[model samples]
Target chain A: MASVLASAHPQETVYGQVGDATVPLRFSSLDEEYKVLRERAAVLDLGGHGLIEITGPDAVAFAQRVLARDVEYLTSDRCMMTLLLDADGQVVDQVLAFGREDGILLESSCGAGARLLAHLRANNDEGVEIADRSGDLTVLGLEGPYAWGVVGRLIDGELASLPFESVVDTTWNGADIVFARTGFTGEYGYQMIVPIEHAADLWRQSLEHAQAAGQEALELAMLEVRQPIPRHEVTEGATVVEIGANWLVDVTKDEFVGREAVLAAFEAGGGRRTVGFSGGDGVPAPGTRVWVNGQDIGEVVHAVHSVGLGATLGLARVDHDLAAAGLELTVGGTEVTTLTSPYIVPKSWSIPII
Target chain B: MTIDELRARAAERQQTCSQIKKMIVSRLDLEIDPDWITDDQPLFGRGLELDSLDVLELYVAIEAEFGVALYDSEMAVFGSVSRLAEEVNPALRA
Candidate 1:
């Protein structure tokens, strides 16, 4: 036990491990005080992500062969957002792949980890290995407009020199870490990947930054960053000729597992159509029926108040004709005018300035 | 054409799939002939053509069926038909 303690790296910081989450900052909702925290300094603990480290001779190639996107030429300093699909071409998980000097770290929704590891093993005959760091790696999200400058101060310049999506190693208050310019919250953010022993130090450091800035309105400003921008939701079982995600298939990449089938689905058009809806204040729940022209068209997938925009926003797959923007849609049973969205545009923090 | 062959084939390919395959089965209240939903057959887009949400529902079904919480890291394994069957079938009996 003494050796174990000796081997553990220590950093200077504090973190709030709230609720029942195994990780920190995994809050159900940002606190009212965070409004002050977000503008100046707000760090969140993302508990739902399962962190997995991949290392082996064939790690890169094996991943390339199985996933839909190409990661063949990724640099250790970059990150790629990609998807994993079934043989039939349905998406299973959307992932962020961070390449490191020794290996690649994949972070995604917590629930899918076990199934993801199983898939890796199935394709593992070629000499790749997967390690689960869900317990070992503690992830912290430091976000805000001022986040970059503050993190730069903390890491002593390693943060500023690194561009978004890049990963670098540096010592923070005496603890060694893998600092990546990656975050789920769209901000000039950084995700500090640390050993569990050092989490408290890092958290404390972030809290210090927030307090020092005195801008306390950090989390409230972050609300503007919380809008749910609909990338695409896989609409299996439901026809999907028009939700716009059908365009996601890129044939130029390595022959994906479900290429021909997706192409075929594309050709057979007339699938269900999806549309965006922005209501006044009422947030629609998933599976809530949608109506158009006095008939049931479809239902809501995922919806939220869109903190970034202040309007309720959602993505709904409906019958073809009504999926277009400007088409009126009511909550399957209520009166709600679905507005076209820009709903809340994200304030750009990383604009290139000469 | 037969149930055992279909089951074997499906159980073989279920790994390359998302949850869509199983979701359709449940929502439609349909059962594989055990000869169908096989590996040799096309299950996702054609013949089966499962979409993304269906894949998610399939994820829920597998968990409910196997009694194991599926995580995102293991998604690739559940990416196919055969693979999911391997995990799901055993867990069903366990």
Candidate 2:
């Protein structure tokens, strides 16, 4: 699926196939876009992300059973990021779930909407109404240390400070839209779920305040903050514990789809844990062997040349005993040092919303 | 470092991270096991879903538990358990 606003994109836009959707990989260059995302603000065409709506009386109940996190008290004005897991506790997709007055709206990770919709429909024993709302609604994002400023200029100033995970039903160009303080890159981020007809206008207006960034830059910034990227990190048979996404699972919930398997994995323990590493000559591909001296401990799960770090940043699923940061590990033939999470401290952490 | 030496170093950071995790869980009264919180999982905004108030509580908890005051430190200090481990136990830092 191509972005709904692709017609408005620049002629120089570079696009790539990512699963079910064809997405812009970069507008100018990855480095330029990445710098904008971290230092200033970058507008994102998140049309590749699927928006699925679940309604009817059992909407919340059905959502409660399907979502890995506790959303029982998730009010209409709030949204939270959680994982949709299969029976085996393997991730289906990481989603931003918005609580709507009628039911719940889920924004699937870029290019994973179809799979998420299928997973939800297959498990919908509660007979709730499931609809793929992507045709009618699409997502746009603004992220960076100064993304809050763009939010104020583009929409409402108050919405910029709506607290993290907070959502509001509002308008843009007189079109009913849902605005949420959602982020992927650990920066001051906000998402606008607008009607398809009004998406192009919002995207253009946003461009005036922020430069456009594509999927590559967005994913790179997310990696820097150690945000779980399901596409890159969720390898086959990799348990949530091994993926280091335990926080996305609500083990405390009495019953949820993958709770049993996730709990079992956690109790089983001693699985390979994922850690961040840097300082490699080239980006290592997934499954590249990670070595500690002569011992083959694990493999690279995901990696990229981080523009922020000016080095190759990657995650290795190493044995639990050797997963901590500040260790010298070899990936393939190049030596890399496992570093602390948030490999690049997000400037948003220090910048407050004014 | 050699394999054994690297293992020892990794173990040292892991121990400190474990202590920090335990302190966070205990102080915040979280229900999950401290070990469940991975060394690399984010601690605020997205991962653990900690808020500013939680940070305030953690500030006191960290000083009491580690005998190190983080009152003046930037919010980046709590980026993750491993990051916090570095601040609480400076020896764990690279």
Q: Number of the top candidate by lDDT?
A: 2
- The global C-alpha lDDT for each of the candidates, from Candidate 1 onward, is 0.52, 0.91
Candidate 2 - CAPRI tier?
A: high
lDDT of 2 by residue, A214-306 (tens): 999999999998898888999999999999998888888899998899999999889799999998688899999998777899999999999
TM-score of 1: 0.64
Task: Single out the weakest 10-residue window by summed lDDT for candidate 2 chain A.
Answer: A320-329
lDDT of 1 by residue, B2-37 (tens): 324323433333332324354546665654422223
Interface DockQ of candidate 2:
0.87
Query: Would candidate 1 be rated incorrect, acceptable, medium or high by CAPRI criteria?
Result: incorrect
- lDDT value, candidate 2, whole model: 0.91
lDDT of 1 by residue, A1-354 (tens): 011111222332222321222222212233443443434455655434557777887778766766665677777777755566667766655566877666677875434555666666666756777888867766666765566666766775556546556777767767777787754333456777787787766766676674321111232232233221222244555322243433233445747666666556666755555555677457777788876455666788756655445566677766543443334457856555433222332232333211
**Which model scores highest in TM-score?**
2
